[model samples]
Every structure is written in C-alpha cells, then in structure tokens.
Target: MGKLTIVAHIKAKADKIDLVKSELLKLINTTRAESGCINYNLHQDNSNPAHFLFYENWESRSLWQTHMNNKHLEDYMKATEGAVDEFVLNEMAEIDS
Candidate 1:
C-alpha cells in the first residue's frame, strides 16, 4: 500500500550490448508516462558497458505490477530474449525517517 522501489540489473551478452541498451532505452519514455510512476531511470556501469541498471519508484505495488504487464515490457522481453545474460530484480520499501 506504500511506495515501491525497484532495482533491476540487466547484463547484456558481450556481443549484444548495443541491442540490449537500445531496447532498454525504449522503455524509459513510455514508462515515465505510466500512471503512478514517480521516476524511471536507467544507468550503465562505468567500467562495464554491457551492464545496465534501472532505478524506479512507483506510487504503489499494484501500479508497478500493472507496469510489468504492459505491452512495451512484453515487447522488450521479446526483443532482448537472447541478448541479455543476466537479470536481477529487487523490490523494496523505503525506510521512513
């Protein structure tokens, strides 16, 4: 019922970095426009070009789940099927001060 933070780490296959990065980039604008999306940011590892991370915050878990089932997300999964080598996702709740 509270805010949700998501940390998603995606590592592209050595030969598919560009493809993966581009596909990942496609999610930003669309995701940012989604309801309940507070922020959707993407980051690439400085030393590892093939590594990517998405830092996201949503108003609620329900909304975030809606985002996960979106068409664009499905497309991204299809587009980057074999291009990614590793994927990890973490969902957390911010500690109140």
Candidate 2:
C-alpha cells in the first residue's frame, strides 16, 4: 500500500494562531519520529495568518491509525480543543505525485 496523506486545515482565532501553530509544530516533530511516519509538516497561509495547515504522511493507513492513538497527538488535541473556530481534516490519495 502507498503512503497515507493527511491534510489538516485549521483556522483559529486571529490571536490564537501562534499558540496553535506552536502546538502543531510539536505534533509534527513527534510524528516524524514515529515508526511509520514518512513526513510531517506545518505551514501557515501567507494571505491568512489565522489559517494553518498540517501535512502529514504515513507509511500506511495502519500506521496513521496508530498515530491517532499516540499519546502526544492526543495530548496536543486535548490542549487545543476549543482554540480553533474551524478545523477541517482531509485525506488524500497521491494519484501521480
């Protein structure tokens, strides 16, 4: 099976972005050190400072599932529960790229 791509589009209060982004960066670094993580990244939208994106890749869907159950990931989510106004998660298949 191919890698699983997870795109987390997060939009929080204008002032909360720094907090959210910092938390996401920790998650990304932790994820990258996991057993099956291929890559993990956090990015901010140039036009919308309050908007952020988390791009993560796992070796397999099972690995991704494992990541969801990871303590760090759970802790991160719990810490930022209501800090966001909009949280959109998207799973993607890399057709050609």
Evaluate all candidate structures by whole-model CA lDDT and list the values in order: 0.98, 0.86
Backbone-clash count (model 2): 0
Tens digits of per-residue lDDT for model 2, 7-95: 98999888788888888878866778899988888889999988998888888989898888989978888878888899898888899
Candidate 2 lDDT for residue 77: 82
How well is each residue in 1-97 modelled by candidate 1, as lDDT tens digits?
A: 6999999999999999999999999999999999999999999999999999999999999999999999999999999999999999999889983
**Candidate 2 displacement at residue 83 in angstroms:** 0.7
Error in Å for residue 18 of model 2: 1.6
Superpose all Cα atoms of candidate 1 onto the true structure and report the RMSD in Å to 1 decimal.
0.7
Q: Which stretches of candidate 2 lie over 4 Å from their true place?
A: none
Give me the runs in candidate 1 sitting further than 4 Å from their true place: none
Q: On a 0 to 100 scale, what is the lDDT of residue 43 in model 1?
A: 100
